[model samples]
Target: MDHRLSPAATARFILLLAIVLFLGGCRFLPWRSSPAPRPGHGLQDGKTAGHGEEPRIVFEEPDLPQPAGEVATPARKRACGSPPPPGRRLPQVAIIIDDMGYHRRIGGQLLNLDMELTFSFLPGAPFTPELEEHAYQLGRDILVHLPMEAKDPKWDPGPGKLLLSYSPERLRTTVRKDLAAVPHAIGANNHMGSRFTEDRRAMRTVLGELKKRDFFFIDSYTTAASTGMEEAAALGMKTGRRNVFLDNVHSRDKICNQIGQLIALAEKRGWAIGIGHPNQATLEALTRCRKRLLRQVRVVGVHNLVR
Candidate 1:
């Protein structure tokens, strides 16, 4: 109990105790170094604690408000400047019966088909006016099936000749004569203009005349390189082209196949125009398929469907 230490030894012991207190009080002292894993999450460094692998953290973004006056209005009112009626859908099938003035029996058969058809009459036929009037009276549209020169000389459309060699004035005169021949015609489509339709100048002249008369143009599309559409668009005319020819083969089976193709095109494009002659076979096939076709899509006049 009476043991005492030297002054130097006591001083050394006191210095060691002071050093330990200083280390404990220091806030910035370096401790065991680690990366400080994100707040309360566990590291998935090849450890299997749960049934499956640990769920990864997904950072969520905050919601942002749209700028002032940048909202989109409903499209119906903006383009036409008025809202369209709710229940109306565009017609799908526009059936046009071309070359209607030559044969009375075929024309009569078309009349008895009992569907809304657009009849295009050949100019200067003996029964042009009569057939046009009959078609109109029977609630069908009338179109002037203008005769233009085709690639083959043997296949003539009809009276009026729309040759490619004619000057602009001559072409205009011929078109006027053709239009005058077929009275009460609402629109015009080429009869057989595979050669003439490819001529841009002739097509422009025809389209210009049609535009002046305020008629729609329907390109028959006999050839793949048709400039009729481009010319009509340039002339600012309401126009469309035939998507299907129902009687290209003049057989019942082939015509039915073409009709099926027409239906498919209508389904794909929302509207399709089909042109056909008033042949007996075509008429019979159309009559047989009219009811079933109408159930799937509306069959309307060509003018009613095209804009």
Candidate 2:
């Protein structure tokens, strides 16, 4: 070490101090923890891969973070000024697409929608089982579309038709077969049973079996005089009916109009179920109007709508 400081020694010491100060002031290195990985929507609960096909990447939307100290209320009650009745809550809409499985392309399109729409498959349809599996894996409700006696003989209820003339034993066997064909069918609805659905004896047989199996019934309302719902209630079975048909006209614009009607009905009542077919127009209408429908009321699965 030098006893006396020289100009060169002093200058070197100053340079070393300046270098240390500069590094400290830079602050470029991160000293905080890493941010939490934002999970994708629909799989926030970590139950996707094991379930249905990864919810067909419809709208790759991320869940919006809720504000602090805030909780979500049911959409139906959000606009309520006064507290609803003890048993009453928000308005909900459950849309069911009937006549699936017959047309593979349209049925697949309906299944891809992540809205949890119910799919009703016609028994004996070529691809009923395959479509049923798809609906089940995706966590959507499935219903076996049972055919019954129609008013006109020319209407033709196709194969597996449940005729009114069949004995009680035959009717029970036929109903069982229809329910078994679908993988996860929780209920059954008539495809076309104007004459049969009105027959009290016939409906009792069908409803009795459904009660044992713990299934529900949805009155398609093919005819105004049908007694399916009343019979199911007598048997202590869960049941509901279609409030509207979205595609009786088979036009996109018409279907959208029908959806508007459904929303209006849902708002008036606590809940409503709209039945549609698996057609191009119906799918297009649903895809376009979902944003608006979801805003006004909660669009739920059919099972949720059952009374």
Candidate 3:
């Protein structure tokens, strides 16, 4: 029956109305949108309840953030080895440590070694970003360990492997995305691209993209039939192919022996390139052969060896 509210009641009504309007306005404010989640640098278990003897973690396609603007340039100039002073005639060797991002502990050990080793990082591996930055800061030559389809269907080449099925445009965009995943990569080398590298057309498409970004390529030489070097030559891009695989046998003795072979080749040819993976045995072998490596040949960054 009351015609109007009491003073206290009217004041409360006005206060509530003001609060509602303030709350509603806050939603449309600039800071209201949350930033996207960034990819984590650690391995998370995607385990199922009952699996095999060991719980296997299946890697999924990484949802790395697509950069907003044009791809950022490398933070620092690419690291290169200084030329020998006045041609003393010491043989030059460039040793590249591949498969770096998956095993951080061993990778750290390998990086800490007092050597001018080059590191090639897998783009979407769990520890890729952190390890790659460390390598860059240490003045090491860095490369995107670009994955490409292996010949065998059973051997998955991990995520981001460029396949023959990809259109030329898709290959180009995929190369950009892979390079973006590993910042400060001055170049790229294949991971396990036995099949893709053999396809001259696919290699040409992928390499053209790399050339546009002023990046070099090194064929892993996974297949003897690979046309990587030839395709790169056609594009007139600076390129090289692996001459020696250091850890194929995964033994310290074998690796050191391979290092010796690499040194011998460099001595014979005046320059050579060798690729190794991040392994304890490889690290141990490198540590063991450090004195020999320095004495027998001049160890340089892969950039120096790439023509």
Candidate 4:
């Protein structure tokens, strides 16, 4: 049926329709809308507080030791050179050949040696990068042999040497430059630093720079009073000292004896790092006796011994 509403009733009807539309649109209004409750909120029916709570622990009786017959005993200690008592264990001995990159012949001779030798190259030397890359490629560790002022002025380590007179900034700059000159060098060791190494301030500066670069330091122990270790330790840098100088005497017999001394030290201390030059006697002795030396100890790299 066609029904017409009066003006007042039409106005009322329109107002009612508008109110319904407004209520329907309220779902999209942020203020009137309510977000769904998140999972694990105990709003869901049939869920209770602490529904997944773990059960209270109950104490148990203490475990008793097994019978002597069921327990395993450690093996007995065997005598030295007695096949290691069936398990392999050897003392670690690290050999480092310092003063490299000076003469190609000596450096090449050292490279030819079968034993794994760490080559410490002097920065700014003619063959520094060549020898460093050669050693690195041969599965040997490379070290930057940093020059420092020696106790005797007559002994010149090399150009751009860090001297005691230089300020800390100059010393750090020199060390950084030297390190950059040697390629593939993972660490650095002082070269003839009997005087400079003794200066705690200077050594600290050098070691601080090395530590910043995440490199290690090996003190050649040129002098008994060297402070490289002390400074390095203060900076939390990985460090090691030369336990034996293989070529201190630079004679076949003396070097052989020194090698023996190195083995003895390695045995006593569980590890030792020996530093030697590429002297004829040193290389000769090392080449001749490396096989025999391997039998007594495991010759490793300087980094292995340090870290």
- Whose lDDT is greatest here? 3
lDDT: worst 10-residue window of model 1: 57-66
Candidate 2 residue-wise lDDT, 42-71, digit = tens: 222222233333322111111212222222
* 101-188: candidate 1 lDDT, tens digit per residue: 6556667778767677788887856556777878877878888887776776655544676888889999999999989877687789
Clashes of each: 0, 0, 0, 0
Instruction: Give the runs in model 4 whose Cα sits over 4 Å from its true position.
Output: 1-88
The estimated TM-scores of all candidates read 0.69, 0.71, 0.73, 0.71
Cα error, candidate 4, residue 268 (Å): 1.0
> At residue 293, what lDDT does model 4 achieve?
82
Best model number under TM-score: 3
TM-score of 4: 0.71
Residue range 40-71, candidate 3, lDDT tens digits: 21223222223322123222222212212312
Model 1 root mean square deviation, Cα atoms? 28.7
Candidates sorted by TM-score, descending order?
3, 4, 2, 1
Point out where model 3 deviates above 4 Å: 1-87
Q: Give the CA lDDT, 0 to 100, for residue 88 in model 4.
A: 58
Candidate 4, residues 1-307, lDDT tens digits: the string is 7699989999999999999999999878778344543432211121222343311211111121121222222122111123233355788988888867655666787897888788888776656677778888898988988888876665566655799999889998998898888858888898777788889988988888889888999987777678898789788989988776777666986777777777766766688888787667887888777777877788888889885
Q: Which regions in candidate 1 have their CA more than 4 angstroms from the true location?
A: 1-91
- Quote the positional error of residue 75 for candidate 3 in Å: 43
Alpha-carbon RMSD, each predicted model: 28.7, 19.8, 15.5, 26.9
- Candidate rank order under lDDT: 3, 2, 4, 1
Lowest-lDDT window of 10 residues in candidate 2?
56-65
Candidate 3 TM-score to native: 0.73
